[model samples]
Target: MKTEGGADAAKRRAGERAAEEVEGGFVVGLGTGSTTAHAIEAIGRAVDDGLDVRGIPTSFQSRQLALEAGIPLTTLDAVEGIDLSIDGADQVVDDADAAAFGTLIKGGGAAHAREKFVDAAADRFVVVADPSKLAARLERPVPVEVLPDAHTVVADRVGDLGGEPTLRSAEGKDGPVVTDNGNLVLDCEFGPIDDPETLAARLSRVPGIVEHGIFVDLADTTYVGTDDGVEERQY
Candidate 1:
């Protein structure tokens, strides 16, 4: 593992910790992110040591990383169901009363469309993150993936729903950031959400919306990494 110092080390601690959850014969949903990369590597090392498992990547980035790590890849079409999923979050907020955390915002990498599909399909979904991602409440810009032709309509609808939507642009290039599925991303800000479920429903109903970043009741457990150690929180 090319584990670095500071936040990267904390991320590694949480990620590798989640990787330990994998058992033999498990089909894993490999999520995308810097922190998730650590878990993928740990799983790959486990594979080298005779761990029998296959992984379904949430995005092209994850697919490539898994391959380089020597983790066997499988498709959702081939697997009956996923056993476990390990992923990182853009932000995770603590909820005093809920089955899972209050709110989770993901898709900073614009992979939420696929990430949500695989993560929600798993029997057990584990969230691994560095302490920086924890928040008092979710306030990050939500990412929504939509067909290119629907960008204008989606943005207007998002505004009608009281969110400020901005088309996500590719880094170091022109034009919008296109997802692996050839969709455009809209980063919508709605301030601190008091009713994530309602907002999620609203976003899902928008025409041409592929997926959104708001994840509620999906995470089974969250592992937050601090400089001291990995802090495990179950909801």
Candidate 2:
């Protein structure tokens, strides 16, 4: 039977497995979200145990976690290339595309823009998630970050793309949620996305759209945490 901490344990299993991918002298792209936080903490523990690696965090939250974990961080401007990136996904889709390794929807924390930039630069990008994240198709609302001035225009363009766009509001604060880059977020619902690339392309063409959460073919491998154990899937 699953304990009260079952979900957390599953996330931890997957996260820690991804942490094992980090090596001495490697520059890692730290991912955002609670699941990814486990990996960050694990990496921190490894750092305390003598791992010599630097981290490039995807968001403020990730940066804070990495700092707490004692994982040294460097900027992209300071690095030649990233060795690996460990990220989390809102949804992971198993598709039939022979050309693609993995398809994912991310940015639930409104950090997708930065996450994509870091993940794409990695020599190997790994996703860490619990089994609940895996799915047959992408069904989550895509988070789109846009310049504050272009919010209205981008929202309209998102509607043109057949997505219902809503400005993402903060939970505890009064106003909308803002990105680390000081941009606003639009949670766009287009329903089950059959072709994420096409949608991503469409979203990208919209001026003021910094980045969207539709991450297609960026991951090389995934560690999925199940109730029974951690499962490794090669993409």
Candidate 3:
């Protein structure tokens, strides 16, 4: 495991490596999180160096970062498709039941809903992370965005699926944490997920589930920063 500072440096290195994949005239899907923030900064620098690209940010924070970086912004409706998406993950698991690239547990920032949308819209989805985030098995709880009115119902349904569902709370606010899409988040713990693909499919069927954080089969590749160097894994 890496220390805090080492992990942060690794993240930046991973982001910088992923940024190398970008090209002129590409419509990139910018992801959220600290690792992705490094990518945003690198992309901004590229723009200053005369690279022409448009960014579709996954969150308000990412949008602001892109704006500051001088990267032109566009909406999904304004673009035909995203050339690439660079993002981070809370955990990356090598599960036999997952897609060839494995599975991801995201939404720590509560932007999984939008992140999923933009990621799927992209031609390629790339994950950048530090070595500490990788695991033999995923242990993080899945984040499920739900409509406020369906919170209780969704919790019950998730419980039926053998998950312990807990509503995510705001850090500085009085109530539950609400997503940018106006939905509440349910952090569902199904310890050591055996089949991420099936789990993601099942979660989608829950009536109130707007989007769940089990990013099954979406990642095309992952760039991991380690003490030695950045390693690239293709799914």
lDDT tens digits, residue span 1-235, model 3: 7543577888998999999999999999999999999999999999999999999999988999999989999999998899999999999975445442458999999999999999988999999999878877778999999999999999999999999999999998799998889999999999988778888899999999999998977999999987667888778
- State which candidate has the highest lDDT: 1
TM-score of every model? 0.96, 0.95, 0.95
Descending-TM-score candidate ranking: 1, 2, 3
For model 1, residues 1-235, the per-residue Cα lDDT tens digits are: 5435599899999999999999999999999999999999999999999999999999999999999999999999999999999999999987556433546899999999899999989999999999899877788889999999999999999999999999998989989999999999999999987777889999999988999999988998888877778888886
Q: What is the lDDT of candidate 3?
A: 0.91
What residue runs in model 1 are displaced by over 4 Å at the alpha carbon? 1-5, 97-102
TM-score, structure 1 vs. true? 0.96
Model 3 / residue 46 / CA error / Å: 0.4
